[model samples]
Target: MTSDSESPFLQSARRTLQLEQEAVGALISRLDGDFDRACQLILKCTGRVIVTGMGKSGHIGGKIAATLASTGTPAFFVHPGEASHGDLGMITPGDIVLALSNSGETSEVTALLPLLKRMGIPLISMTGRNGSTLATHADAHLDASVVREACPLDLAPTSSTTASLALGDALAVALLEARGFTAEQFALSHPGGSLGRRLLLRVSDLMHQGDRLPQVALGSPLRDALLEITHKGLGFTCVVDGQGRLEGVYTDGDLRRTLDQYSDLHALSVDDVMTRPGKRIAPDILAAEAVRIMEDNRITALAVVDDTGHPVGALHMHDLLSSGVV
Candidate 1:
């Protein structure tokens, strides 16, 4: 009779996690010359990294390829079975092949060895068996061995797959740093995602430009500036000089401060009450940078200017939030 405290289900789950965790930890000591050689081979390759595997290894290879591609390394996955069926045409002479197999005996993956060698393409093998045929014939071999599977039967691939995935991530990140890949470059590759929008989207993309911008000429009455702010709904309006260069900005906060200083607001000019040289950003700068500027200064709006400090556009906190740039 199994008691609730000694439930076999809970015990099995905990054991599985522990085994897999230990398997990944064990890989730390195995990082040696082979791992370094693999990275060097991939780094020097002028062409894309071609990842190939069979069955469960293939699924992990696909994810590895994706992570590498997204992190500034050009990589893609090709199924070993498909590679045998004329899909080997995808491999160019300049490319590097990364083949994954736990036992290093996957027939589909191993069968491509002769052709890869014949083509003079560099091959990096990731396998558990150091003496396996696949490892012996490779230019570089990455050992992804495990003591045992997390499975109670010790047959299913659980810990082995986890180790392979972690190793793949480590390789990709190392290469990314080696190449000096910047966030802007990463954003360029992932333009459709939220991260891309935040890093790549510039102030010009979200700002209200031209007629949509709320602006009043220098010396305009406070009443006119307030009306412009209300009409444009940007919470503020830029006060510009005769040459369109920015003079100041008048916001609701400025209005409150001015009212406290002077009981009569209508008699004053926009320049008199406006905050001089308020927070501003260039049109070409990142919207994320604009958000940082706004947050740092504790302001919600900013004037987008040109090289001459001329008011070109207006940016608001709502603009960033709505566009997923905040």
Candidate 2:
């Protein structure tokens, strides 16, 4: 019920988003040799990329570490506060360190600089100030500076954090491409996610085979085909020849059409009503692809066939949904 002129919340929210968007845009022009050097250091490292930061920077560092890990780079987050106590041991001499500090002078993070230097570990710093202590000590410094904070008071870490996150994503994507990371490899890292299901869940994994498959002989009576469909609960049955090779498919849709054209359902056979050269899929294809085919053909189910054209299995729309492949 509030008017736009009186509602500071909506206006403030828009200003924040606009400022953050501009901050991210500014990062594109700032990319230079330092960014490439950071990528090279990470690529050459034999061990994991150890990320550390303090305060709001720490939250962004954790997300950056996760993105790097999931995108083929071996990376993990170690709190800078914890590093001073004993967590520094997690970082090995072979690892590369990515430290985040908006001011480039976080005490918790700077405290470990000398020790890491002595250990000969490469340091990559992301900071707003080019002349900050952390940036000065870093082997490669990435400028993640923002012109102003989204906060009206310019106190909260909003635009700066957003810019840092976008830069992290850029680095991860560059490294992912350099390593020739594939969707299959990504799926291996994210087996429980929807992307993993789409890339890894093949037709063979979800298809019904043997007695579970809804199928009948090509000469099967229309009643027999209907019973097969009812028993299997797939709403369709594949019709195969005497050699068990797929010949056609008879579904509820076909049954309705037959009923409309001819009232004698008992006298009809599968050969009379079945769709010849019905849509078929191989078992090795992705279940997502099956969904696409079913959608494209306006079908609810499909028959899985072997190289010899023999019916091996059946895939239903419900199976795709149940397995999270849809």
Candidate 3:
């Protein structure tokens, strides 16, 4: 490898980055009432937003469609060439069309303008030229124009495509906020990911309950508490009253403190060292909340309690980690 201080490859890479940055940056000022109108149109649509484009725009359109669909807006991409064929039937009367084209006169995309108009489907155009055929025929035209392509020959689609993708992302986010989309709702849309696991998995789902729960009476010998912690492998044990309600907890930290404060371990009862009212969570609460509670209090395990304050289960930080929610 050459590893030159000023390699031509590095120079080209930097130029491409600078141009693409400016391309996306230019979109900020162009955002106006048309952006709002486009959002309103999609939000009001009873059906999906049909995105169409030719060449590079089609690739960006596909990503835009995915973002919109995942963020609460129902949307999908259709190739302009395919739409000209029998695939135009995919677009229904209730649907809206979002067309992308840099030149704004791409024959394949522009050909659909008349058909969309006759069907009374609202059209939102994202193009480089506002006066171009596609933009002039649309209900709301989004200007995604860039100064020039990052290509040395100004031929390949680089800056223009980046700008279009950014605009698509802007549209999806604005519509997401306008429709009051939330993290919980987004988690529902993406249930296979880590965020979904964290949000959807409840404490009851991951907690150790019944026999597996480490628990003993408050007045039990400290030796008994240590045995429970070791047996359950949760590094902590819940100390309960005679009524089975949680009175306190004895953890590895408490064990260390006890060793420092007292000379004898067998001489103590759980009441001599257990932390009263240790951090607890309801079984119905989200496991993510349990994680937050553990994080804020700097504790590893939590007592899962019922409305009556009886420990029903036990949760450990390891449980969250193993579940891919940490």
**Model 1: how far residue 164 lies from native, Å:** 0.4
Candidate no. 1 TM-score: 0.92
Task: In angstroms, give how far residue 253 of model 1 lies from its true place.
Answer: 2.5
How does residue 280 of candidate 1 score in lDDT?
A: 88
Best by lDDT: 2
Of candidate 3, the 10-residue stretch with the lowest lDDT total is 1-10
Q: Per-residue lDDT for 1-326 in model 3, tens only?
A: 23468789888888899999999999998899999999889989999999999899999999999999999999999998988988999999999999999999999998998899999999999999999999999999999999999999999999999999999999999999899999889999889999899878999999999899999997899999999999999999999998999999999999999999999898999999999989999999999999999999999999999999999999999999999889
- Score each candidate by Cα lDDT: 0.93, 0.94, 0.94
Q: State TM-scores per candidate.
A: 0.92, 0.95, 0.93
Q: Sorted by lDDT, highest first, which candidate order results?
A: 2, 3, 1
- Candidate 2 yields a Cα-based lDDT of 0.94
For this target, which candidate reaches the highest TM-score against the unseen true structure? 2
lDDT of 2 by residue, 1-326 (tens): 44667678787777889999999999999999999999999999999999999999999999999999999999999999999999989999799999999999999999999999999999999999999999999999999999998988899999999999999999999999999999989999999999899999999999999999998997878999999999999989999999999999998899889989997898998899899989999999989999999999999999999999998999999999999987
- Look at candidate 3 and tell me the lDDT of residue 65: 95
Q: Kindly give the stretch of ten consecutive residues in candidate 2 with the minimal lDDT sum.
A: 1-10
